[model samples]
Structures are given as structure tokens and as C-alpha cells.
Target: MAKPERHPRKTIPAASGPTNSAEEAKDGKDAGYNAGMAVFSYIIGGIIVWSLIGWGLDYLWGTRWIVLLGALLGAAGGFYLSHMHGLTRQGSSSGGSAADRGPSQDGAQ
Candidate 1:
């Protein structure tokens, strides 16, 4: 005895366009999500590290205000780092090169 063969009920056609807007939009969303995550991580990391240092200093100095100062400094440092790393701003000077932006009108290279 032989068993019957199975077949797919439906088939999907391939896309024929030069560009895929859906894919591009997905990529843009992913990039934005990644940037947001990076910013969050930077801020959190700074806070943790600075807070730890402040805690240690406070313990050694027998004081309770150093931890607060450390937390504030960490926050400021994190924001500065994020801005420097281009995670805080969009389309800023840290973006792509001149060629990516477009041709240079100025004669200098």
C-alpha cells in the first residue's frame, strides 16, 4: 500500500519593487529602539558606577552627602557621554561624512 502526497494550499508571490518601504521603516524603527536603549544603558551605568564610588567615599569619610553628589555627577556625566557618543542627538555633526550628506560646494577638500 502507498500513502497520498501532501501539497501546500497556497503560495506567496515575490515582491517586484525596486525599494521596500516596509523593510526600510522596520530598520528605522530598530535603529531608534537601539539608540534609546543605548542612551538608557549609558545613563544607568553612569549612575551605578558613580553611586558606588560615592558610597565608598561616604563610608570612608563617615558622611552621607557624598552619595547624593556622586549620583548627580553620574547623571551629568552620562548625559555628556551620550551626547558625545551621538546617542542623544539626531542628525547632528557626529553623523555620516560629507559624501554621505552630498557633494561639497566649497572648493576645499
Candidate 2:
């Protein structure tokens, strides 16, 4: 009987690294959680600090409603801070404007 012909084996490329999708997802989740916590902390901290100041003012001036004003101001300041931070973040990430990007997909400029 004739000898069987031999073929060279194919070589598979090695993976770059052992990266896991679950780990990536977890990291994304953690980052989101951290951001949310930071915003919450900012708001809460603003409220607490301003409320204390207001309370002190109320005591010093013998008024009753300054604490409420302080709380409102704190809330507004917190929202403004968060909005600014969000704008900054968007600017950094987007790196472009609507004009730079093309027109709307719906044909509305």
C-alpha cells in the first residue's frame, strides 16, 4: 500500500490577554455608581453646610426662615455645580459640536 501523504498542521494565533466581558461590565457599573455617588454627596454636602450656616444666621439675627432659604440656595448651587460638571464632561468626551458633527438624521438642521 502507498504511504499516506502528510500535511502540515495549522497554527492558531494566541489571544492578546484574558479579558472578561463581565469584568468590563462591572467596571462600567462601578464608574457609574461612583459618579452618581459623587453627585449625591455634592448635593447633600451643600445642603448640610448651607443649612448649618443658615441656622447660625437665624440664631444670631433672631429670625426663623433663614434656614429654609439656605437649604434652597444650597440645592440650587448643588444643581448648578452638577450641571457645570456635566457640561465639562460632555465637552471633553464629545470633542465636537453639532455643527462639527453633521446635520440631524431627520434632515432638520
Q: What is the C-alpha RMSD of each candidate to the true structure, in Å?
A: 6.0, 12.8
Q: Compared to the true structure, candidate 1 yields what TM-score?
A: 0.64
For model 1, residues 70-103, the per-residue Cα lDDT tens digits are 9989988988998999888756454786678886
Q: Give the winner by lDDT.
A: 1
- Give residue 19's error in model 2 in angstroms: 2.2
Q: Model 2, residue 41: what's the lDDT?
A: 76
Segments in model 1 whose C-alpha atoms lie over 4 Å from true places: 1-19, 91-109
Error of 1 at 92 (Å): 10
Q: Candidate 2, 67: how far from true, in Å?
A: 0.5
- Judge candidate 1 against the unseen true structure and give its global Cα lDDT, from 0 to 1: 0.86
- Which residue pairs does candidate 1 place in steric collision? none
lDDT of each: 0.86, 0.81
Q: Give per-model TM-scores.
A: 0.64, 0.62
